[model samples]
Target chain A: MEQVYKRTKGIRDDMVSGFCPGCMHGTVFKLIGEVLEELDILEKTVTVQGVGCCGLAMEYVTYDCTTSPHGRACAVATGVKRTNPDRLVYTYQGDGDLASIGLAETMSAANRGENFTVIFVNNGIYGMTGGQMAPTTLIGMKATTAPAGRDPKVHGYPMHMCEILNQLTAPCYLERTSCNTPANVRKTKKAIKKAFQNQLDGKGFSMVEIVTSCPTNWGLDPMASLDFLEEKMLKEFPLGVIRDKSREEEAV
Target chain B: MARKFMKGCEAIAEAAVRSGCRFFAGYPITPQNEIPEYFARRLPEVGGVFVQGESEVASINMVYGAAQTGTRAMTSSSSCGISLKSEGISFCASARIPMVYCNVQRGGPGIGAIQPAQQDYFQATRASGNGGFRMLVFAPATVQEAVDMTYEAFDYAQRDRNPVLILADGVLGTIMEPVELPPMRPEEEVKALKEALSDWTLTGHRAEEKALILPGGWAGQEDRCRRNANMYETWGKDVQVEEYETEDAEVILTAYGICGRIARSAVRLLRKEGMKAGLIRPKTVSPYPYESFDRLNYGKVKAILSVEMSIPAQMVQDVELAVKDRCRIRTCLRSGGEIMSREDVLKAARELV
Candidate 1:
């Protein structure tokens, strides 16, 4: 063997990740890094991360990184992209950061068709804040805020972000994928890469919602959490492409 | 390069472009709506970007993002809109990103009025945002001053890697005057300016390199805050004040923005009556021209009249601090969107002299 296989150069070797053990954020970060390295955009990319466990991507990502207030990552990334139209800009936000407090910014940016990418990590709970109820928490899911279980009458149903964004004419790409099984992990990586490529092509707004797991927040083992993501979360938020206007742009 | 009649808001928009500002993101509001409207039609002509953001909150953060790339970016809003931008301004301050913004102020405490008023003096000079951070506030008295101060505000922002504010009022924002516009910056010069700040900007760097922009969320922030305090101290030398006819005066008048311009007219009228009167106007309100008071001939000066277009007067506190109670201090006040007249200032100066 020529020993050609190695770690992606898009990630920092000396940096210590701040994510908890068995957190799916590490896997998502690696997928992003591998994609950036393969696409040769690691040097020109700027990452704006929200305030959460996913926001810790600033420490591990090799690109220039910025931190936004809890839910303003999309707004901040919009600033970065509009100001420096030449550079590649993206934001990594958690479920609570993207779909809850930041819902206004998320929708507005998508409507404007901002030329950037958003990597939304949907882990069903707020991992950083001790598993608080997220907008994406299942109808029966339990959280610190929802002590017993989520009730649709009071708590409201989980937000389907990709489906909501798909209806917008501005966004050129919108996809939902999971990181549970090896096959699904491969698909998630591909979706992330496609989103980045859409921005590079100047096709306007793109987003990749990765259905992830939080072992500690969910109070389950790492393997059990992956099973839960596949069995329950996948049923509600089906994994597939919801919108792909990029294909139309290609034909033009 | 051209001398043309223009509204204060329109003149500021042109000056920002001439100063190499390539990014403008703003939302529309009364008194300041001309700023964004002007930029929308003008920035693209100069190879710049202009975005009418969804709201004041979004517009300011967009400026924050653009500024990190080492470009001159800015936004403009009125009193209430500025309240929404406070959070974004705090983030820019903590991150040490250089950007400029303008507040064409209106009467306020909460949607008080849309007309001209200087009620925001306390808000602009004192507590702009959540942090202990202070912005170098420029209070322009005329459309000419508005053009000049706005052109230089960008440099002040880049010098300290912080935010600078041009605090005008609705009177200055909507009124028209003739201004000699500065020369438009060449495209190459704009690129050079951005390149000059590359060492600290968030532009893509190699894997081994690090860009330290945290935006108010960071570890070991105590040390970073102390560094900011040291920078604030140096602003004493950067203070700008215009002194007119202060030599051998019996009474001095202190004001800022349009109030300063109105008081200047009052000074001329008082001097004609053979009453010794002078004017001390601050161009930068944050690093206030406290030294101008020290230069006054205390032996000849009897009283200092603080004139402003606000209720119960807010700038009196600063004037008192500068005077140190060396002489009598009186405030000529107006509010509820009322413009302070030259006659009122003359009346106040007559009582003191």
Candidate 2:
């Protein structure tokens, strides 16, 4: 018998993940694990996860990691990267964690160009706390908090993190990705790898924002959530690499 | 290093370097400003890193991250800044990361004043963060004491795998005095110290027993906090206090930080006046010297006077706990950046006698 594929060494073998069925966290986690294992930096990396679902990485990741206080993963990662420059460090954050409560830390880390990677999962809702409206929630989307759908006059518009970060001069890479399709999943993994590679190369802050689906919160099945994602979420958070210094010369 | 005259905050920073603190993250605030300033200039020279973070919350989180890597890390802030840092401090406690920090305390209760005030004693010893976690807090009365305590705090934090605090006031922070500084820790020694912590310190993914548990190594919140409570119980053996001339005295003067120093002087003045006055000063305010008060002969001591710069008398609550009302407790206090005067303490001791 020929073994084509097996589990990634990047995730712990003894533990089962707590991600909800149809949640993209499982898919994104698999991608990050595959990328870490492929790069062979599993033993050389330290991860800081912000509060919310992203914090689950602290339990399942094969590498040593810490779950910082809500919204401070970027600051914690900044500490790790600045002090242990030899160690590969990254932060996995949610939209609520990064854009809402931790905007100061995220913006400061990005502006300072701290040499680290950020895996931002923007699922348009705070999944861990029971589907509250998130900073990335679509204007017309109804969350637990915004029962009648997000009103622009009251709740404000969804934040485009990649574009916001693109305004900063220090970022080495800024990309928005998704996991709604196999090709998009591959691109998300590639974006994560590039973000990690930027850190290994001693480049400044790099962020790969993954526009994901939350089936339970979206009130739809996993497949239907993908349909809503492509039909709505993509329109607001368009997928693309907002900035890549590596392609500066080519673009110019 | 030889005895050198230096500002209290700057000397504390230098002492941290000598003690092998290789990482510092802090924000700018009064009195403690010299600490970040000194680190900003000196840390790079010693191959250490210094960051003037966007805020105290961010700065302490940075220290938390750095300390996870087995690095000797620290952060310092003033009263209101320390209030802002409480969130990160609680996080570090939750994670059980070893690090040191100092509060060159200013007036509090919503930025009450920028000058030194002893108003944060309750905040420091009671609820630095919400987790019921305890830190070994050192109350230094002089520049020399501040330098010495800051120097030794790192080793204590590393040994217990807990955070330690140097509680100083603006007067101690701004005063220039000569200190017999400790010898500079060798770079190799610092490296080895960090390496020795590799068993627990975050160093990337390791397939080992330590790597198996959740971060902070607890089963749940109750289990985590209960374990820390157990560790704190053992710290009863580590309480440090200075009891002076209390064998047989009619009045016992008790205080901490600058107020303690003033109380000591008041003792001298009371002695010169032929009044039987003694002093009980707690060097470690957290593991407070409760036993010191137990050792006092209540039959001989008629009154215990609590002197502090906090108007409502924060540390006096501890003094009462220490005395347990066996002796009458009195307080001579100042607040909002007003340093307690030896004369006021002297008069209060005379009244108590």
Candidate 3:
């Protein structure tokens, strides 16, 4: 029988993935590669990979790519996108890289409506650093730094990046999605595709925040992590389109 | 090609533009605010881009991004702000992307003052950032020299695939001087220069070849470090120094940046008094003019008076390293915002004699 599916050319054939089993980063990265391939802009794309597990993309992506200093990917992408306006630039960042250390870089870029895309992977814990509490860590989630489970009194509330950025008028599109199920994974891909399309269309900032799981970091089996994600993670970061500038433009 | 009166910061910015610098990302800081302000007004006129980044950290990283595109990019900040940029600068150097930046220095161990001081000599030459990476740090004393160094900095950066620093002080950044501005490079020439770097730069296309860059944290860096060491060695030969009447002088004054400019006057004053004195000034402080120190008539020169704005004498350490106890070394003092007086330098020289 003819093969019904195959790996997208967006990923490097020699790509060596070091992602842990049950980690959703593999799924999210595949979606980005596939979306860039589907959009037929693979050759014109440059990936700005942040530190953490997300930095693993630096190893696998076939596109011209560079890793920025931890938390500076957004700012770096701003420079690349501005100077090479004809090129498609996007930054792939995790919770610690984005919402923690790089929050100002992200917010300032979003506020300026930089014509680029951001792939924000919010797994609620810092996985590569052995599961320290991330900005998106749930109120009661246990991390290496919050061994007794996160306490809001001391750790503050888990940050909702999409909701926080939604206050800015600059971002053209902001959406949150997950890859727990096949259907949710497909939705995540769609969200990612739309974000890229907005950038290609010269629309302002577009972001697809992927609510994901860190099974190893959470000290749970991959499948159990999904259960926990759905039960608790989604409550703090409900997945849906946060804003669509196209809809507002159509109304205008 | 004709001389024009210009302020140091604005002159450097304009010279950078003429030198084919098509991208600038900087935040406002004292003494260097005119750089970003000038770029904001000038870059768009030349079809270039300028971003007033949210912070110096963001600003330097923005330059990092622009450098990936092989565009001549730059950023500027003062003392503490430079400390913030050191992280991004180190990344740029590690990634081996060519870019230029300027430090219109203010006095500081920590935000010491808004006035000019040569207090960052060590930071500029030794520890610009983490990672033991060194730059061809140009300490231009006069506004005209600042303009010339800023103009040529981008090419040196591209040639070495390294970040270059124009280490200026507030005295230079704020002063106005007449300068023969470098001719503006044609726009097409700038494009061609940027395109020539496509083989290694991040052009964002894979039809030919994909370029992957790992900043600072890449494995197999021993080879890169070796390559950088070779480059630093080459810079030793290229070190530029001006030795005024060191042929038969007993007291030679040593300094860089504004102090160097002042020492030149002191040399003339000492000559008027029939005291054999000379000046040795290093134009580039990183691959410092150690050879110039060797050329000093150790047989005749009894002392090297190190003049600087920093009290504890930062540049004197380099002087000591260069002189290596061959001659008596005395420090002429100032700190924070205080500029050196020629009389202080002469007093220290006479005492040394």
Candidate 4:
């Protein structure tokens, strides 16, 4: 019998990813690796890794990667791209890294129209730090910090990044997709590809927010975590392209 | 190059460009705003990148990123603004990223005042950030020295793979003085310099090779700390200080930055009066010219006086440690943005004697 499928060249075959079993980071990393392979830009691409569960994406991804202190990946990515304009640079950031401590950097980079890509993985809880309440942690969700279900009165409501970033005029693309189901996972991959393509075309700032899940941190099995992300997380963060300016000339 | 009367901030900006600094990121802060302003117009002309970051915190990280790419990068801010950048500076040091920054210091233990003061001497020399990491610090007294120090800082930073800071006061930042600018670094030279760092820069590498450059490099916490300690030990060899008229003197004066210049004037006045007064100024305050005191004629010197722009005196502690109580030490301090006057330094010297 012949093999039907082999690992993508964009990812290193010999290395084991540090992400936990059933964690969606592997799915997202695989998708990114496939995208890099499809685009054939892995040789010139660099990944700015954020500090969190997403930081370990470097272990699996073959492209050059540099780590930034917590929440500064976008800012670092801006520098990397600005200095090496010919290189394709992107930041792989988790919910806490992109939303809470790094909110200013994300908003400012997008507002300035920095020429880079931001792959924001919104998993609702701080997975690496053992499930602390993230800026995107849903209301009534239980976290290590919020022992008794999160209350909007104290914890505040969850932040919607795509909708917020879509309000900015400079972004060439802004989309919110998920990896919960086969269909949604395909859509998320397409969204990531479009973001990367926007950078290659010199279109300006592009961001793809992918709704992912943390099975271990969510206190659920892999299947239940996917279901939770589909039913609950999707309610807070909607899926689909929120902004696309690449077609503005055709639309006009 | 022909000498031009330039403002301290503007000269430092041009010197940074001449030093091959192609990436400049900064936020507007008092006494240092002109630096970013100059780079905003100049950097684009030289095919460089200049970003006016939303905050000091963002600006330093931007430099941190650019430095990781092996580009000569820099940022500037005043006293409290540097405090805002402490975390990123700490990260840069921990990661062994090379970059330069300037502190056009102003009065502050808090948001005290915007006028000139050397109150940040302790902050810049002793504890720039949380980690016990030390940077090569240069305290310049004039626009010419500031320009020279700022230009040389890039080389030192790249040589040591560490952050180098220019500690200048608001007076030095805002004042105009004649300065002979350094030659502009050629574009090809800049590219070649960056290319030389390809082995360590954060560029994409082959899949089989390990390309990760972690903070303090592939070592555990304690081991990294030990490596950092060893690096500092090597850097200790670069300790630099300037001694003026100390030979055959009975009383010696010590200061840094603008205070040192004032003490130099006081020493001149004391020397004309036939009194034996000399001056010792530390150029690199961290490696700090302790040996300058060690080489002093302790048999002739009666006492040491420190002049500074801070109340309760900060640099005096370092001076005391250097002198080791071989001679009496006294301090003349002017706080809350008060400039240390030469007359006050002269009077302090007289009292010490």
Best by TM-score: 3
Encode model 4's per-residue lDDT on A120-150: one tens digit a residue. Answer: 9999999888999999999999999999978
Candidate 1 runs further than 4 Å off: A2-5, A248-252, B351-353
How well docked is model 2, in DockQ terms? 0.66
Clashing pairs in 1: none
What is each candidate's DockQ, to 2 decimals? 0.71, 0.66, 0.81, 0.67
Sorted on lDDT, best first, the list reads 3, 1, 4, 2
Put down candidate 3 lDDT per residue, B65-136, tens digits, no spaces. 999999999999999999999999999888888999999988888988999888888899999999999899
TM-score of chain A, every prediction, order shown? 0.97, 0.96, 0.97, 0.96
Model 4 - which docking category? Answer: medium
The iRMS of model 1 comes to: 1.3
- The local lDDT score (0 to 100) that residue A103 gets in candidate 3 is 97
Query: lDDT at B156 for candidate 1?
Result: 93
lDDT of 1 at A220: 93
Candidate models: Cα lDDT each? 0.90, 0.88, 0.90, 0.89
CA displacement after TM-score superposition, residue B42 of candidate 1 (Å):
0.4
TM-score of each: 0.96, 0.97, 0.98, 0.97
Q: Estimate candidate 2's alpha-carbon lDDT, on a 0 to 1 scale.
A: 0.88
Sliding window of 10 residues with minimal summed lDDT for model 1 chain B: B210-219
Please write out the lDDT profile of model 1 over residues A192-246, one tens digit for every residue. Answer: 9999999998888999999998999899988888889889999999999999998
